[model samples]
Target: MSAAALVVVKCGGNPAVDADAICADVADLVRAGRSVLLVHGGSGAIADLADRLGVPHRTLVAPDGVTSRYTDPATMEVVTLALAGGVKPRLVAGLSRLGVPAVGLTGLDGGMLRARRKSAVRAVVNGRTTLVRDNLSGRLGRVRTALPQTLLCRGFVPVVSPPAIDEHDQPVNVDADRVAAALAAALGASQLVLLTGASGVLADPADEGSLLRTYEVPATGAPGRFAGGGMALKLVAAREALTGGVGSVRIADGRVSEPVRRALNGAGTVVRLSDMIPSLKGA
Candidate 1:
């Protein structure tokens, strides 16, 4: 890690991904004197908790084919309960075991992440555009860097997550990757690393070896070849971070040992503004 490097790492909430490896990598970085912030989400855990609580989990598909969780009042309650109660603690414990003083924080804490709630969202239902009301999803606004920076000053690794409070002071579900991007931008981080289940962005979703080693992303908008499922939103987040002046954005597999180090060393699809075209060279 560079002496002045500040990095924001987003650990995917997918059950298949090994978050322990990510936390251990973070511990190594912290011990090496790097300032790191870990951003995570608990959608998988939230769904399980919702099922046990008899709360139905629903997803809305947008016109552009992107699917997002339908965060009604009850679902938002489940989100808050599961993310704060279940996921954060495990991550904190894992980091602590690795010798890093990890402090878990949600967006609702100290107004760490302020957002603007979307009153409603347009979705494609049965091949038609429909309005879904009372959606508790939000777009992130100002991020309070002081809390995390203060944690850094105190030699603690800040493990942060969503349920960002909106202008109305209501907790709203926000995308974790986007939240990481916003936080990285706020801190002027040297790199933003998004760890996922796959090795990197694949030319074919089913083929791991088809990893596109480098992608030249625009400061705005999504590129055509890399658009699909969760990867699409990650692309959007990458654009946000790159546009906000992050040095680089990388998406890599979190299941491997030393995942963070591999990502920083270019073991995944790295997106930067300078590359004129996307390159599919093997990593």
Candidate 2:
């Protein structure tokens, strides 16, 4: 199958999102001869396991106000276990039940997803800006596409997750949305669909009726003040996908039926590089 026919879907880890529906949709797509790759996050599962294991779960707010899970050594272990041991298996099994040949993989497998470990992350902690040195997170550096491509060629749907390997061969937490973006770009996928709990990107985060049909991200800075919480990160990932050669990117509601198909059929906020600020076109 041509890479241009490939579609990468990232399923949000929100408990309210329907994973089974997404799996069924993926199975339908596969049967229709469209190459699909599924990426997922397990934040909810991570928190649950952390609670069961008596690990204190914490979050870090960057100076810019973007919040992320604080992955200390303990939290990193929980993340790895929750994603690989919990989430990936269920997704692969669900796909198989739907008659789709599926394979589960982590970024640590085949060195497929590589990153540079962050020694410290600057964040606002306890109302004071500080450098958090114990963070075990990383920023993606490279994606080895051969593994996924080979699997896709063999007709297996690659269900992938994080805990990407870093420079020293250590597992480090990485954002799952960015992982989808990297894979979509690396695979030259025609579309990247990010399914969340809400109805696309809303002008008013609280109002679903305020859903924007299209959102234009600023070329040089953060999306906008309205882009808060996970939406901000999703926008960043969408921009990266568009910039990295994805044909289009959509942020849609994962709660709806046939979410992937809906997004592909224009049911979410469509983001494109051409919609960026004119002055900062190449920035």
Candidate 3:
């Protein structure tokens, strides 16, 4: 598949972000003859499962305001079960119902997504900045694009998620948005769409109407405005994809129907390299 015909989409794990709509949109895109790679997160599901399994679920906010699941040994098990067994099956079934050939895979499968496990993480805990020594988190490294491309060429949409295999052949949790960006960059995808709960990156996260329709990434790879919550990590992912030669990146709403088409038509925050602005990095 040519880069122009390929799109990489990351589906946010927020409960408000509808997976059904996303799968339907993916089906529409594939049916329209576009190559689609779907990457998803299941934070909500993980939390629920952890509660049931008596695992203490904890979330850590990095110094940079990016929130992530604090995956201890027990939590990692829940993440694996929730993402693969719970969330992925529904997405695969939804795509199948829509007649789109979808193959579900984890980063561990075929070493599709590889990362280095973070031995220690710096996070704000109990209002204090501390280094967590036993964090089983992974920062994305190489993304094997050929496997997904082969599936795409054969008319199948590849649905991917964490936990990615680390250098030691261990499954470690990785951020879904970053994984999507890596895949986009590796596949030379022309467009990368991130569908989240909110309409777009808001000037004020509390004010929904304060949507920033267009955001320009900093040329220096520094943080720009609207870097907070999951949006901050998403901004980082967008930067990676754009700098890696992706044609465009759009952060749009997943709650709406036909979200994929809407994003393609410019219904969200469109990011471009020429819109680059200088700003200090956010902590």
> Which candidate gets the maximum lDDT versus the true structure?
2
RMSD score of candidate 2 (Å)? 3.0
lDDT of 3 by residue, 73-175 (tens): 9999999999999999999999999999899999999999999999889899888999988989999998887789899999999999999999999999999
TM-score sort, best first:
2, 3, 1
Report lDDT (CA) for all predictions: 0.85, 0.90, 0.86
Candidate 3 vs. true structure, TM-score: 0.94
Model 3 bad stretches (over 4 Å): 220-222, 273-283
- lDDT (Cα, tens digit) per residue for candidate 2, span 162-248: 989999999999999999999999999999999999998887788888887877776657666557888888888998998899999
Clashing pairs in 1: none
Distance from true position, residue 240, model 3, in Å?
1.1
List the candidates ranked by lDDT, beginning with the highest: 2, 3, 1
lDDT assessment of candidate 1:
0.85
Clashes of 2: 0
> Per-residue lDDT tens digits of candidate 1, residues 33-148?
88898999877899899999999998887775556889989999999898888999999999989888989999999999999998789888988999998899998999998888
Instruction: Tell me how many clashing residue pairs each candidate has.
Output: 0, 0, 2
